[model samples]
Target: MEIELSLPEPDPAEQDREVIETLINDSKYTSFAAKYLREHKSEIDQLIKMKTKFGNTWKDVVKTGLRVPNSKVGFYATDADCYDVFGDPLKYVVHSHNMRDADPNAIPQRVVGGDQLSLQVSDACKERIISARCRFARNLTNYVFPTSISPKDRVAAEAELKAALDKLTGDLAGTYTKMGDLSQEEQDKMVENHQLFHNKDEFLVKGDFYDDWPNGRGQFHNNDGTVMVWVGEEDHIRCMSLEKGSDISSCYNKATKMLEHLDKHVGLAHHKDFGWLTSCPTNVGTGMRASVHISLPRIKANMPISELKDICKKNNLDIRGTGGENTGFAGVVFDVSNRRRFDVALSRCHY
Candidate 1:
């Protein structure tokens, strides 16, 4: 049929007026709400009064199931669909986007992507301009009232604020553009790889041996040059034996004896800096727990699960869920036990 369909062009001036109006109204309403809250003094009672006074205002601004702008992904604003425009118009207007199929590379991407697109500014340059305008307006409102400002004064301040805000918003947008964004996953990985240890000072471990090799002395130096020493070979060996515990009781005994010897020989001043070296809430009653990284793939699929549980129990090892409860996702648990010793220094011999 040789017929073409086209959307009508929006009036630029009219749209600009609408955006200016929205920003101004938002500022005014917010100021009014703030003043009301101040007057009420009691937040709970004030909130109840506000809800009653502006119940219909909420309905006009918000729509059901509509996500508010700038609220972040996977989360919604409280009472998002409710209007209460006087309360926080900035929240409502900031999220309002009008652009269909907004480009990711668009100028002022933050503003255009969601509810921000509804502003009167140009598609190419408006987002930043509007953001600047909004910021300036809010700042001016705060400046005028300091305490007792009227809603009309706040609205009047928008034009002056818009100019300043636009400039600042543009500068900010440019900065953001220069710093290319990384995906959330990449950011998480970077955070996870950050260094865990911060202490660089030396620490001492001391203990007395009770067995044939009593009076054994050992010292461990960390990469940071921190040193810890324990007196007595049996105490040192008992500490090392934490990983080879036949039962929890045996592990506890060795850990306790090691600590006692350390206290007697070196004293708390020497090794107290090391968190693991001291008796804390988690390891207080049990000392340090040794954990072994095990590969679960070695276990046969057809083997009876009950036998595995019994074997673990006999070995004095606690069975733990890797991914899901009872169902083994990984072939083995990272075998962890407390009642054993960790060789702090390779050069130091255990009792």
Candidate 2:
């Protein structure tokens, strides 16, 4: 089924034409939202009036860019924002996904590769690889995106996930710790170790993701901490697996196993047009990001950051700081991950 969107009559007085025009013209404003608004000035009126079934409007979609002119993604509250409010912007979408083109008739399906005994990297490349991680954003088929989910429903969703997690046995047995129950020290350690998520992200904050603070937000990790999941983040759930060195197979296998268990109990949302529905369009397809932390001192020393970025683009890889997206690399250690998240075979997407 298609997403629902409303095109209400444009309100002239609500159009902050000159104000938006000025921001779009600012050199610091280079996010996707800014670019879209600048190029489609005429659609501002319609965009302002457009609303998703959950009541997200253009203001919700572009607030990130307006609030932080230098924001990378800008942001979108729901899946419908991609086609309904943003006009699809085929060029931008395809480019963002690092795909060749968008074929209207094509229905891309997700194909995951989770071999437990295989490694994805070459022996030589493995030397520089510090760790491997696999994670995917997921939402429930019956629930609205986090940005629009009511507090009561959000709590219900978390309870449902907790029940499913409680059923996990063997290596997957663990605890679900709510953000509200975490102490300052506990939160700090998790953040330092990259085991927890914070609600302070400007983009998500502007998108209205942390409505009731940490009421329904929490995280679950296996006894060993290798396999984990974040509940009520940007998406309804984010399943992850981490392994030392370049063990893609183990990472993928563990994450996929947890995801399958969750799916068996709580059903994940999926669509023909968008393999896995998510809060943001960028993660629509597989919604998976498989990455490796590696030391690249030689490359860092010899090539400029811009040149290295171009090379990464050519190779369908994205390099970021060890801290994650929008952060700068820490010395020579960098997080290298797949750039194409949509329209690609999931099996191949991870490699």
Candidate 3:
């Protein structure tokens, strides 16, 4: 039975020509900005194309593996500068739904094939790596610029660039460290999880499995030999089978672990004031609290709309309508309690 899924239609009216114009204007300011944005736009277009491919690849991978509801995996750029450049930093907060959620029979078709999906993931990973490299290069740019160009302005720019590079480096290093430290037992556990829906024949026949799965065989099969060919293990090409909440917890865990490692490696004296010789007062001890992205659709519907405004004031949550003044549709920003202390104990307790 063929099913036609109803997809959300794009709103032409919602497109912000002004923001695009502003970005074009902003790009003209610095040679770096102009060159970087040109490359960024190209990368973004490639990312969209890759996403289309990866979406299909992931579906095929799941079909050959285990099926789990709420399984999702997508790349998110976490840097502040990228967020600003993209025009909506908070949009990353929304979770992406899988094809199965949208359409159960959404199998690997010509356009949405496994190869495309893998390519998409590769492209996204590449984009992230490129973004980091660009940030690092920006620091070099600042250093290359002469000290004769106003010490105060140069110093401020240098500090900003350094902070951006440091955060990116720390995050990348932390992820690698966590992955490298994973025990053999832990790796086995992941395999075991995959084996839950394992079919010996299919799992073992591993020659370009993604592109050629079920080729002209014309049907999916199960381990028990049921004619229900749509019964093979769910393919998880991107490891979306894992729980998202758990993923967030894992990220928090890694951050704390890295901080602990840094504390030990650099020693207290070295990082007494977070290694900043002239530290920003705002980030002195524990920096800003964790910020959460929340959808306030109801607030938008009822606004100028003082009722929600009162609530926001009482709760200390910042509310912006539609697009934040600068960028539309970015949603509201809600601050999570607890500043940057990286309370390992609290994180553990929550876990």
- Leading candidate by TM-score: 2
lDDT of 2 by residue, 1-351 (tens): 999998998664365454467557887887776776777778766665667666656565566667777776676545433444454542364356454665434434433334343655788888999999998898887676787788998999999999999999998899998888999788879978888988788778877899998888899999998899999999999999998988877888888788778877888877665566677767767788999999989999999998999988788888889887789866999898988778765656744
How does each model score on lDDT?
0.25, 0.76, 0.25
**lDDT (10s digit) by residue, model 1, range 138-216:** 0111122111123453333333332222333211211111001334454345334321111111111111012121111
TM-score of 3: 0.24
TM-score of each: 0.20, 0.81, 0.24
Ranking by lDDT: 2, 1, 3
What's the best-to-worst order under TM-score? 2, 3, 1
Runs in model 2 with CA error above 4 Å?
1-29, 37-50, 79-99, 103-117
Distance from true position, residue 35, model 3, in Å? Answer: 41
**Model 3, C-alpha of 135: deviation from truth (Å):** 17
Which model scores highest in lDDT? 2
lDDT score for residue 293 of model 3: 35
Candidate 2 lDDT: 0.76
